[model samples]
Target: MSDDELRELVHRVDLRIERLDARFDALEKRMASVEGRIESLERTMTTRFEGLETRINTKASNWVVSLWGATLAVLIPLLTLWW
Candidate 1:
């Protein structure tokens, strides 16, 4: 093959490589954006779950305390009668 023809082929290959590199860079930017959004969503979900857990714990504790109070109110009177 002629030197000119070989040079032309090499130049074409270089252009193709540059285009591929640009495409890769664009893809990387898009992936980074998606990763950032996912992280934000995860943080929001975690905060919401933590708040829900706190509410559930508070409600359960209140229920237990109320139940204990009611049980004692009934048991104490019965025990006194037996005594």
Candidate 2:
């Protein structure tokens, strides 16, 4: 209604806006920290899974080689006895 009252209202609104901005900035910082932690966890899990896959592949190869060796050892003796 008066110029002084209008000015006071504007000042109060400005203060509220500043406070809201500060809160948003703080929330943004916290979100960034949480995102960083999540990325780090994903990298660690990826490394662990890759290691497990390598171990499984190595074991499978070893089993295949052992199976072939055993089959040949048995076949050779039978062939020699028959001949």
Candidate 3:
């Protein structure tokens, strides 16, 4: 091929490479954005789950206290009557 033809070919290849690079950069930005959103969602879910666990624990503690109190209330009077 002539030198001029070779130069033209090189220029076309360079243009293609630049276009590919730009496309890759755009894709990378999109991926970063998606990753950020996923992380945010994960944090929100974790917070909600923790709150649920705390509420359950509080309810269980209250139930335990109430059951013991009721048992004592019933048993104490019976023991006093028997004695």
lDDT values, one for every candidate? 1.00, 1.00, 1.00
Model 1, residue 33: C-alpha shift (Å): 0.7
lDDT of 1 by residue, 3-60 (tens): 9999999999999999999999999999999999999999999999999999999999
Residue pairs in clash, model 1: none
**Per-residue alpha-carbon lDDT of model 2 for 23-51, expressed as tens digits?**
99999999999999999999999999999
Candidate 2 to truth, TM: 0.85
Candidate 1 stretches with Cα past 4 Å from truth are none
- Model 3 Cα lDDT, one tens digit per residue, 1-83: 99999999999999999999999999999999999999999999999999999999999999999999999999999999999
TM-score of each: 0.85, 0.85, 0.85
Output the worst ten-in-a-row residue range by lDDT, candidate 1.
1-10
